[model samples]
Target chain A: MAVDTKKCVGCADCVVACQTENNVPHGFCRDWIVENVKGTYPSLDMKFQSERCNQCENAPCVRCCPTGASHIVEGGIVLVTHDDCIGCGACVEACPYDARYIHPQGYVDKCTFCIQRVDKGQNPACVDVCPTYCLHFGDLDDPNSDVSKALKNRSWYVLAPEAGTEPQLYYLR
Target chain B: MKEELMVSGKHIAEIYPVLHLWHWEISLYLFLGGLAGGILFFAAYFFIIGKEKEMSTTVKWATFIAPLALMIGLSSLLYDLHHKLYFWRLFTTVRFTSPMSWGAWTLLIIFPLSIIWVASFMKDMFPNWNWKWKYLNQFESFVIKYRLPFAWILMFLSIILAVYTGILLSAFNARPLWNVSILGPLFLVSGFSTGLATSMWLSKNDAERRILSRIDIFFILTELFLIIHLFMGFMAGTAVKLEAFRLFMGGSFTISFWIFVVLLGLIFPVTLEILELNGYHVPKWVPPLLILFGGLMFRFVMVDAGQITRFLY
Candidate 1:
């Protein structure tokens, strides 16, 4: 996933679309928006970011899960098997991004990158609903894919890169 | 120049990671697990060393407490689980890298072994008691005959159980306060100290009490050294770890960690034990009780404060 920060207007259509599409429970979210403001009032700089699970290459959550419920699937997407999760919260604490939450129904929940939709040849609800076409989702493994092309021509960075998670989410500057 | 950042569409319930997921239940479980480990270790250590007659309370009586403490601790862990019914999944497979998996398996082996160890000593504590069934009686006899070997196994398992309590927290590298390697040894020493204190309190023999107190003072000193080393290591590390160090140095957890865990728990108890060892008129119960109190507070403070220290803030 690559998010074009310059084009984001903080409208949060993606947030609503995700909630509706994923059936994410009320008072909980798998994705959200962050607005960062820098500099003084007379010379202000602001950026809005749409954030969710990083689905890191070196996901600590997967490594720390005792029950193997939080495992990596094809395409390197980290997922939780609800029935297998004991919900001990080890993965919750191990996650550097604070992306996971304990589902009210008694399991850890987090963004799956809308793998269900992606598997069906459709964009994630968040990416599809993005008004500015700021959110791009595709295989980084395929150089001609949307995410690869987005990253090819722009300066991009992942959140908490120093944590060495090798996060898959790319924010285009 | 002043700058402000605003985050919208993020609910406080979901985004706030501080003590939200794990709270008092986990802390209590850690405390009880450590205490149980301490009890079993001392019990087996003395039994294997032929101090069973002198340290009867430690070797016999305290051995019974190990299983009970562990069961209660495990119950707390179960209660804290979100998917309570799915906890059986912990045993279906083992992930070596996951400390929690190691703990579940260790408990599976140790909990039963602890019970059998207690039953083996049951006839000694109550000479008239006997198993209701012949096979049960025969099994008890076999356990008694192989008691020495059981003591060694118990000692080994107890050490793993004690160290595991700390490793469980330290394994989470995302939480800066708990990511240090020192927590393993530190928790082990603290568990032993608490175990010795419990035994000392229960022992009627002044000699046993004095011996345990002297040993406990050593454990307490070791625990203190490890704690200081932990903070110093944090201070010399990354910015996030320094912030974690500040959590006890002068941050929100300062008074709790310093006053309860350090002063009342370690320093005061050690002073009392030292005085008692030197033939001073210190009460026997004071140091042990303080040590136990401090041990509990230590876990509470560590678990609560650790959740607050994160890499991203």
Candidate 2:
């Protein structure tokens, strides 16, 4: 996953699109827009960054889950198996990004990158509905993939790389 | 002339989440689990060294209390689960990467080992009751025959269990206070100290009481030093890690950490213990009771404070 913050207007369209498409419960969202304001009033700069699960390669939640309930699946996406989750909240504390929540239905929940749509040859709801085409999704492992080309063509960075989570999500400037 | 514009923009706090997941129940579980392991460790160590007869009160009561504490602690854990019915799923597979998985298996072994440990002392525990059944004598003898090896194994498991209580929290790299490497030994020493305090309360003999109290003073001082280092280490860490230290220094958890954990749990008990050791003859129950109460408060503060600190925006 790659996000071009330069193109974001902070309209929150992707946020609504993800919530509606993913059936995110009331008062909860699978994704959100983080508006960062830097510098002084007259010389101020505003940066709008979309935030969600990083899909970490070395996910702490997966390492600490007692029942193997939270695990990595194909495409390196981290997911929680609801039926296997004991809801002990171990993964909740283990997640550094604060990206997971205990669903009202009694399971840990997080963004899945729209696995349902991705499996059916469709982009994630957030990327599909992005008004400015700011969000891009593709296989980074494939050199020909859009995400790969975006990474090659533009300078990008991952959030909290110092955390050593090896997050799959990238921010393209 | 260059103009200095005052920096003013919205600082969004919504990205920082405050989760009330594990609460008092979980804290109680950690406290009791460590206490149980500590009791068994000391009792079994004494029994293996042939001092069992001299410390009858310590061994006799600890044998039963060890298992009882674990049972109650484990029950609290089960009750804390949101998916209580699916608790059995934890046993279907093994994941070395997961501390909770390893903890479940550790508790499973501790349960039966604790039972056998208690049963081995049954002949001395219920003299008249054992005489009523001849088969009971055979069972007792069987347990007694393996007592030496059981003691060694139980000791190993007890230490593991004690350390496991701390590792459980430290494994969560997200919480700065819990992610430190010192928590394991800190918890182990604290567990041993509380166990000694508990024995001091239970034992009637002055000699046993004095010895346990003296040993506990060392443990208490060690705990105090470790706690200071825990905060110092965090303070020297990254900005997010300093947030965890703020929870103790001057944040919402400050009063609880200073008053309950530092003063009541460590300092007060150690002072009373040292005074007694120097022939001041303070009341026997005061120091030990303070230690036990302090231990409980320590867990509550740590569990609550750790959750409030976060890394992500």
Pairs clashing in candidate 2?
none
Worst ten in a row by lDDT for model 1 chain B? B12-21
- Which digits, one per residue and each the tens of the lDDT, describe model 1 over residues B1-313? 6767766567848456353678888998888888999999999999899999999999998777789989999999999999999999999999998999999999999999999988888889999997889998999989888889989999999999999999999998888899999999999999989888888888999988878888898899999999989988997999889889888887999999999999999999898888777878987789989999999999999998888888862
Docking class of 1: medium
Q: In model 1 chain A, where is the ten-residue run with the lowest total lDDT?
A: A35-44
TM per candidate: 0.98, 0.93
Provide per-model DockQ scores.
0.72, 0.52
lDDT: worst 10-residue window of model 2 chain A:
A35-44
DockQ for candidate 2, please give it.
Answer: 0.52
Model 1's chain A TM-score stands at: 0.98
